[model samples]
Target: MSIPPPLQLLLACLAVFSCRHFVASHQESGDWHCDPDDEARIAAEFRPGIVTLDGRADDWSNVDGFEFPLRPALDPDEDHQYKSGKMTVKALHDGKDVYFTLQVDGDYVYSKGDDHKCPSVALMFQIGDSATYHNMGGCKESSNTCNSTNCRGYEVDIMHFSIGNSIPGRLYGGNSVNSVGLVDMYSWNPHCRNIDASAPSGNDSTALNDWKGAWWHSSFSTHPGFIEDDSPYGSSAEKGIYYFEFSRPLRTTDLLQQDAQFSIGKSSKFSAAFWYPSDGNPWHGSAHYTISCDWIPMDVISGLTSQHKAASGNAASLFAFVLSTAAFCVSIFVAYMVSKNKSIPFTPIDDRL
Candidate 1:
C-alpha cells in the first residue's frame, strides 16, 4: 500500500508533465466550487464601509501593486488629530458572474456638516489618486494632471466647505461654519450658511453634494488600467470612480458594475486610501484605520479553466494563480533544454543477427 521513496520522488516529478493541462484547467475553473449563498454573504460583508478592495493597484497611491504595507498607511490630516488604515482585499471568480464587497472604518467619522470653514479637513474617497491625471482636485493646476496617458474616473467628496474658507473650485462648498450651528467666534461672513447640511450635493452632479455622515461611494469602470497609466500630478477625465454621499438613515449602501465586465485568470491585488484626522497621537499623529474587501470574478464568455471545465459554479479568487506559475514553468523548461544538448542525442545499437 506504500510507495517506495524513489517511486514517490518519481511520481512527484510527473506533476511537471501535466503543467500545461493544469494551467489550462485552472484558467477555466477559477477557484474551487462554492454555493450561491456563500457568494452572496461574501458580497454583503464589504458593502457597509468606505474602501476599495475592488479596484486597480494604483487606486490607493502611485503604488504599482497591492501590498498592505505599501499603502499610504492612513496618516493624520496633519500631525494632530485622526487616524486611518491601509485597505486590504481578496477577490475570486466562478466563471458565470462576479461581485465585490469593500469596507473602510475608523474610530470616528468626520462630520460632513463641519465643511472646511477655515482650515477644515478635506475628506474624500476619490479614485485615480494613484495616477497624476486622476488625482487632481478642484484647486490643482492642469486639466489632465498627467503627462503620460490620461485617465477618466470619478470621486466622492466629504469635506468642510464654508464662507470663512476657500477651496480651489468651490464657493458655498468650501465653508461649513454657521451652517451646522458651530460657535460664532469669528466675524459673521455674509455668505451661504448651508455648506455641510445633510443633503445631496447641492442637488447637483458634483460629488461634494452627496455628503453622508463622512462616507461616500463612486464606482468606476472600463477606464485605463494603472499598468498603462502612471503620472504624479493626477489626471482628469481619464477614468476613475468618485461619488458624493447623502444623509444616512438607518442604513446606507452602494454597488459597482463593470462597464465592459471582463475577468482575467491572474490574481489581481486590491487596495484603497482612507485619510482622516487623529487629533492627538504620536508618529506624526498616524491614524489607524481598517479596510477590508471581497471579490468574485465573472465568467460570461469564457470557461472557468482553459480546458473548459465548469468551475462547479464556485467562486475562484481573483488572483487566479496563473502568471507566476507560467513564468516558473517557462524557466524550468529553458534550463532543462540547455542541460541536454542536441549533440548528445541517445542512439540505439543495431543488432545484426
Candidate 2:
C-alpha cells in the first residue's frame, strides 16, 4: 500500500520551512562579528610625563599597537587617485589623559609655493552614540555643499596637524563639527593671524616650522583659546614615515573644544581615515586621495567593564536558545510523521470480499 500524496507534501513543506529559518538566522549573526583586527582592548598604563608630545618613536617603544592596511578610495574619480599604505596606531593612558601615536609609511611631501609649504595629517573620531554612517557622518548634497542637518546627528572630533609655513599654511588644530550643531574649530596657524606670528622654525629639531593654537565655535571666524600641545616629527632614517604624538587632559574646562570621556571598564566605537596630496605643490597641480575604516569597538585602556561581559554572555545565551528551539520543533515534527505513518493500518486484499 502507498502513503497518500497529500501527507508526503505536508512533510516536505515542513522540512523546507525549517531549513529556511536556520539559514536566515545564520546570516543575522554575521552583523555582530566585527573583524578581529579592527577591535582592540586598550590597557591602562599609569605613566605620566613619560610619553612626551615629541614626534619621536622612542617614547612609543613599549606600547603595543595595531597595524591597519590602507586601501585606495572606495570610489575613485578624476580628482582622487588610488593608493595603498599602512598606519600603525599605539595608545596608552596615564589615568588622567590618553596618548596616541600614529605612524604613517609615506614620504612627507613638502611643497613650496608663493609664501608657504604643505605637509599635514588629520585624525578624526566619533565621540558618542550618534551618526548612521562612519565616513564623514553623511553624504554630500552637492559638489560644494553638504546638508549638515541630514548627514547624521552626531559630532566628529578632528585633530589636524600640518607642517611648514605656506601662505595658507596648515596648523595644529582641534575641531569638532556636527551635522546638526555649530562647528567648533581652533588652530595655531600663522596664516590665520589669530595669534602673533613666531619664527617658522622650532628651537629644537622636533618642533614644527611655525605653530599657533586658538579655539573657535559656530564658525571658523573667531578664536577663543590658545593651547598648543600636539607635536610632529619626520623620520630621517626611514625617509617618509612620520610620527605624531598627541596628549590632552582627560577632561577640560574649555567650552569651545570637545573632550572625549573615558571610563575604566566602558568601551567606545572608534574609526580613522587619512588624506594625502597628489602633487608636491600646495596650491596647484596634484590631486588628493582619501581612505577610511569602518567603526571598531574599542575597550577602554583600564579594565573590562561589566557591561561588556554581560553583553558577551547574552549573545552566547541567545544563540543557544535559538538552536535549541529549532531542534525541538524539528523533533516534534519527526515524531508526528512517524506516528501518522504507523497509524495507517495495513489492509490485506481478500478475493472473496
Candidate 3:
C-alpha cells in the first residue's frame, strides 16, 4: 500500500500545503457536551427501487424521515439555531446500495463555481471502533504526528457535497479523486482527513469515492432536467426546501478500511451537517449547522428481496390451497363414514320404555 518515494513526497507536500479539508477547520470551543435525542435513529428500510436518487422528494413521499433542528456545529445553543426549519433525513437501501436524502427549508441561494456562497451538506459515519462523533474521529494526535499507525481505531468516513460547481440534478462522486464537488473522504481526526486512497501510507489504488449524489432546490420550477447553462437555476431568496440525494454501495472493496461498510440488520453511528449562505453572506467551513452534537444511530434494516417476497407469497397461496383441499377431503370422508355406519333414527324415550 505504500506509494513510491517521489510520489509519496509529492503527496506529502500537497498535504502539507494545500489539502486541508473543511472538516479540519473545526475551531475548538470550550468543553463539548451533548444530550443526544434518545429517539434520533435513522432506519434504512429495504426499499428496493423506491428511490430514484434524482435530488427530488416526490419519490420519497412514502418513506419516513427523522427530523432534527439545525444547530451550529460548534455551538449547539437552541437560541441560535437555523430559523428556516429542521432537516429531514430519509434513507433506504436496495439489496446492492444504500440511499439518503436530506431536505431542509432554505431560501434559494446559488453562487456558481463558488461553494462557499451556495449551500452544502455532509454525512459522517463511524468506521473504526473508537471513533467519536466529536473532533472528527477524536484522535489525540496532532496534524504533524497523526498517521494510520498512531491513529488506528479512530477512522471515520465522510461524504461532502458542495453544489457550487455542480449542475443541479447531475450526479457527482465516484472512484476517482477528481469529483465535481461531492467527495468521499476519511479521517482519523480533523487534521488527518484524506480522500479515499489518498492516504500517505496504506495508499489503496483500488479505493474509489464509492459515492454518487445530486442536488436540487424546490424553488426550481423545472426539475425535469437541468444543464450547466442553467446556473443559478432559480431565483435567489425564493422560499423552498433544498433536496440533496446520495447513494453508495452497501459494501466496497476498500482494503485500507477507509470506507464504512454497511450490513443489513446492523447499526452504525452517524451525523449530518449543512452549510448555507445566509442573507447572501458566504458561510465558512466551521460555521455550518449540524443535526446533532453527538453521533446519531442508524440501522440498516433487513428485508426480504423481491424474489424472496414473491416466493413467500407463492408459498402462502400453496399452503392455503392445500389446507382447503384437505378440509374438503376430510368432509367427504366423514360423510362416507356416516353412510357406512347406517343411519338409524332413534325412537322416542316413551315408545322405547
Question: Which candidate gets the maximum lDDT versus the true structure?
Answer: 3
Worst 10 residues of 1 by lDDT: 183-192
Misplaced by over 4 Å in model 1 are 1-85, 92-99, 110-141, 144-271, 280-353
- Model 3 gets an lDDT of 0.83
Cα lDDT, all candidates: 0.25, 0.40, 0.83
Among all windows of ten consecutive residues in candidate 2, which has the lowest summed lDDT? 190-199
- Per-residue lDDT for 343 in model 1? 52
Query: Which ranges of candidate 2 are over 4 A from the true structure?
Result: 1-46, 73-84, 112-117, 132-135, 139-152, 166-238, 254-259, 279-292, 303-353
lDDT of 3 by residue, 89-109 (tens): 999898799999999999998
**Candidate number with greatest TM-score:** 3
Pairs with steric clashes in candidate 3? none
lDDT of 1 at 212: 21
Which whole-number lDDT from 0 to 100 does residue 331 have in model 3? 100
Model 2 score (lDDT):
0.40
